[model samples]
Target: MRVGSMIVRPLHHVILAAFSFIMAFPFIWMITSAFKTNDEIWAYPPVLLPDKLLWENISKAWHAAPFDLYVFNSVFVSVCIVLIQTVNSAMMAYALVHMRFPLGRPLLAIILVSYMLPGAATYLPGYIILSNLGLIDTYGGLIISNSVSVFTIFMIYQAFRQIPREVVEAAKIDGAPHRRILWTMVIPLTAPYFVVTGLITFIEMYNNYLWPSLITHNPDLYLVSAGLRSFFIEGGAYGMNWAQVMAASSFTILPLLILFIFAQKFIMKGVSQSYGVNKG
Candidate 1:
């Protein structure tokens, strides 16, 4: 049994390593292709590495479009949305978990059901409302339309439910306000979950394309995803500049990669805690 177990563990690790490489290969190829020439990129043998690194491809891509503005817009909008979602989700989750209300369970049920609905279903109404309010082609339209996220609320609710009722009751008995308990106690305890949710929200907002494209006709208001599409089709001369396109694609995901590298531990911790709470 011991020998069998040892063989199984090694096999499991090898399998996982193979799958990891397989998943990462495309990203690896993109990064490598960024340094390759147009000819090398389309080489029949598929050049895995460049004969000589062309640092100029990155510089050329940067200058090909208003990428700096697009990147700034994406970062600013994504951060703003994450901040707004964090606050609203925390408040809603706190109320749902700690505060007694007549419609609490039903409200939660409704929210969960809404989550089950496809996001595309909201586009028409969202567009009409934003149009009526005259928010189209503006940053406010982008940020305000995504202010409330059902997923963020649900994730925070799950985390908040893991807190001990007795601690909250003690705080209440001591004449502590709900806001005080939430800020000083609950939030600190669930900080990992907040980090996880914030990271997820940021990535989603940053990569969002369809909705932003539908609402904003202004090139300056384009998110990273939309900007990349534009660059690939228009700026890259309809894929004639493959190296520059690869370079642009490579750098666009840099922020997300950096974020994941830093917050990976917190994400893992949050997931484990949430899983334990659900199991309990």
Candidate 2:
């Protein structure tokens, strides 16, 4: 059995290494293509690596579009969404999990059902509601529409529910107010979930293209994804500057990559702890 296990372990490692390479290929290609010339990008034999790193790609791409404005819009929207959604979800989840309220279970069920509905299904109604409120083409419109995420609420609720009831009851017995309990006990115990959820929300909001594209007609309000689309379409004299597009793409993704690198430990810890709680 030991001999068989040793052989299987090597095979497993090999398989995982292969899968990791496959997963990383697209990103690697994007970065490499960013530094390649247009002709080199579409070279006959498909150059996996660039012979000469054209540092000009970055400057040219930045000059080609209003990337600064798009970046600002993306960062602002993503941060707002993360902050608003996290706070709202945490509060709501705490209420549903720890408080005794009428129709709480049914309310949670309704929120879960909202998650089942495709985002595309909500586009028309969401647009109509924003239009009615005269919020179209505004930051308020974007931020308000995305502030309450049912999926975030549901995930945080599960984290809240995982807390041992005895701890909460003890806090109450110690004359702790609900707000105090939430701030001191609940927040500390469940911070991992909050961080993970906020990161996920940030990524979603940053990558959002469809809703932003539809809601905002103003070019100045374009988010990174929408801006990338416009940039691709208007590649100036050299139609579809592949290298420049790839360069812009690299810039869009680099911050997210850095964030993930820093935050992945929390994500892993949170997921593991949640599962461990379930098993216990």
Candidate 3:
């Protein structure tokens, strides 16, 4: 059995490595194509590498649109949404898990059920509310509309459940306020869950296209996804400037890549911990 296991483990790793390369090939192609000339891009045999690196492609792509503003808007909105959701999720999850109250279970159930509903179902009402509040086409609308996230609440709820009730009771007996106990004990113990949820929320908000497009018409308020679309249509000249398009695409996703690279360990740790908690 041990010998067979050893053979299977290496085979499993090999399969995973092959799949990883397959998934990454497009991104690799995009980065390399960014430096290729137009002729090389459509070359008969398909050019994996350019004959000469054209650094100008990067510069031209950067200057081709208001990408800097787009990036800033995306980063700012995503960060704000993440922060707001984290706090709201943590507090709500803590209450649901640790504090007993009337209709608590029903409230949690309702929230979870809402998550099961299609997000598109809520867009019309969400837009109407924002319009009534006169927040349409504003950053406040974007930030406030996404301030609450059921997924984050659920993630944190499960994490909080892993904590022993005895610990919370002990803190209560020691005269620690609920807020104090939550901030000092519960939050620290579940930091990994928060990090994982925050990263997920940031990515979702950053990549959100349909809702943002529907709400925001001003070019200056456009997120990265919208900016990329505009660039593809206008600055890219309908794919005539393939090199610059590739270059723009390559840099646009750099922030997400960097974030995932830095937070990958925490994500893995969080998932493992959650799994262990469930098994326990």
- Deviation in Å, model 1, residue 119 alpha carbon: 1.1
In terms of lDDT, model 1 sits at: 0.93
Best of the two (1, 3) by TM-score: 1
- TM-score quality measure for candidate 1: 0.95
Q: Residues 72-154, candidate 3, lDDT per residue (tens digit)?
A: 99999999999999999999999999999999999999999999999999999999999999988999999999999999999
Tens-digit lDDT track of model 2 for 1-280: 9999999999999999999999999999999999998889899989988889999999998888889899889889999999999889888998998999899989988988888999999999999999999999999999999999998998899889888999999999999998999989998999999989989999999999999999998999999998888767653543568898899999988768988999999999998998898788
Q: After superposition, which runs of candidate 3 have C-alpha atoms over 4 Å from their true positions? A: 1-6, 234-238
TM-score between candidate 2 and the true structure: 0.95
Cα error of candidate 2 at position 231, Å: 1.6
Q: For this target, which candidate reaches the highest TM-score against the unseen true structure?
A: 1
Candidate 1 Cα misplacement greater than 4 A, ranges: 234-238, 278-280
Distance (Å) between predicted and true CA of 49, model 1?
1.1
